[model samples]
Each structure stands twice: as C-alpha cells, then as structure tokens.
Target: MLNTNNVDCCARVRHGPSVAGLQQALGNGAMSNSISDIENSKCLLVLATTAPTPIPSSPAG
Candidate 1:
C-alpha cells in the first residue's frame, strides 16, 4: 500500500546528453588540434548552439 498525500512529487526533470555521451562525441569537448591548424585550413565549418555575438574592439592606445 502507498500513501499519495504523504508523497511530495515536487521535482524538476531535465533531458540532455549524459557526460559519457559528450566525452564520446567530442573527446572532453576540447580542441584536439592547435590554432595553427585552423589557419592552414582552406575552408572552415563553424557549429554552435547559439548565434554568435560580436565584441567591440578596444581603442588602440
């Protein structure tokens, strides 16, 4: 027998890839190559979850 009134079902549920999934997909989610490798590439493919925002450059001293 279970008591419904005594139980508090107050909780939030979140859904997404697990830690193991991230490691397997991106190898700790870090760049495996150096920045120089990107410079040498003829083409680039950028993938992101959100739109990129431009940062205002600082005035030259």
Candidate 2:
C-alpha cells in the first residue's frame, strides 16, 4: 500500500537542517563507508587464496 502524498516530508525537512548543513559542509558526503557494487545481484562469490593455518608462528630471535 503506497500513498502518493507529501507525507512526513515536512517533519523530515524540519529536522534535517543541521544534518543537511553538516553534509553540505563536508563536501556533499564523506563516502568513507563501503557500499555494494552490484545492484540486484543474484549471487555473490568470495574467493580466498590463503587459508589460515592451525599452527602458530614462533617469535624471531
């Protein structure tokens, strides 16, 4: 059920000034976090070349 209206937009606008200002000051956005490169992906494949060994390494002399 979707309502085509300006629902909650005013409240969001009223509360978003500081957030918007900070984003604007920070050059639009930080873009520091990781995002999914694939859109609507059916499956993801992760390949690890090296597996961790059960043995621990000794300290160097």
Candidate 3:
C-alpha cells in the first residue's frame, strides 16, 4: 500500500503475465500453471516477489 519502498509494482506483480508460454516455446511445458494446478500439487516451486494477496485466509473458528 505504501509507495515509500523503492519496489513499485505491487499491483502489477499480482496481475503480471503468468509467463507460461515464453518458456514453453523452448521446452516441454504446460501452457499455464493455473490456480488449480498450484492447489493440487504437493511440490511446487513458487517464484514470487510477494506472496499472493486477496485469497482471504481461513476464518478463525
């Protein structure tokens, strides 16, 4: 929320291009790793500058 940090593009990162096609052009790769894929897989290589936001946390019961 604060722009004081030199790192801008908080919003852009969240909506950035998924980069699913560029690499695929050179190798065997899935077109896109959709949210479902990330949720279903046990092992994942998450490469993000920031953790995903807006995916509301579970309610404390």
Candidate 4:
C-alpha cells in the first residue's frame, strides 16, 4: 500500500542559504582545505546544540 513513486527520501537534507549564496558569489562551492588542515589551525570555532559533558567516574572507586 506504499506510494513511493513521488517520494523524496532525502527531502529533509539541506544546506544553509549562506553556504549556497557564498558559493554563488564566489566561483567555488567546495572547501578550500581538508580535515587535515585543522591540525595547523591557530584557533578553532566549535558550534553545538548543547554544552559538552564529562563522563562519570567508575562507581567502584
């Protein structure tokens, strides 16, 4: 009974408008550097939905 002909499995996937707009304003849409480049970065910017938490210590202690 499933109607799959018109469905888009990846419909929920998307990129922010800033990313697309910048790619249009500039000539390229791909990153200039790779993940390895992060190793040499002097500063880093991290974005997350929640604050990081530490793991609980062992109960045997």
- Model 4 regions more than 4 Å off: 1-12, 16-19, 47-61
In model 3, which regions exceed 4 Å deviation?
Answer: 1-9, 13-31, 47-61
Which candidate ranks first by TM-score, i.e. highest?
4
lDDT of 2 by residue, 1-61 (tens): 1776533333244336756765888755344334564445667675853347332233334
Model 3, 1-61: lDDT tens digits are: 3766555443344333444444557453334557897889989775764455553233335
Clashing pairs in model 4, backbone N/Cα/C closer than 3 A:
none
Backbone clash count for every predicted candidate, in the order shown: 0, 0, 0, 0
Assess each prediction's global lDDT (C-alpha) against the native.
0.53, 0.49, 0.51, 0.57
> What TM-score fits each model?
0.35, 0.22, 0.29, 0.37
> The CA-based lDDT of model 3 is what?
0.51
Give one digit per residue, the lDDT tens place, for model 1 in 1-61: 1855554321212112444566788777345678999999999887763337543333225
Better of 1 and 4 by TM-score: 4
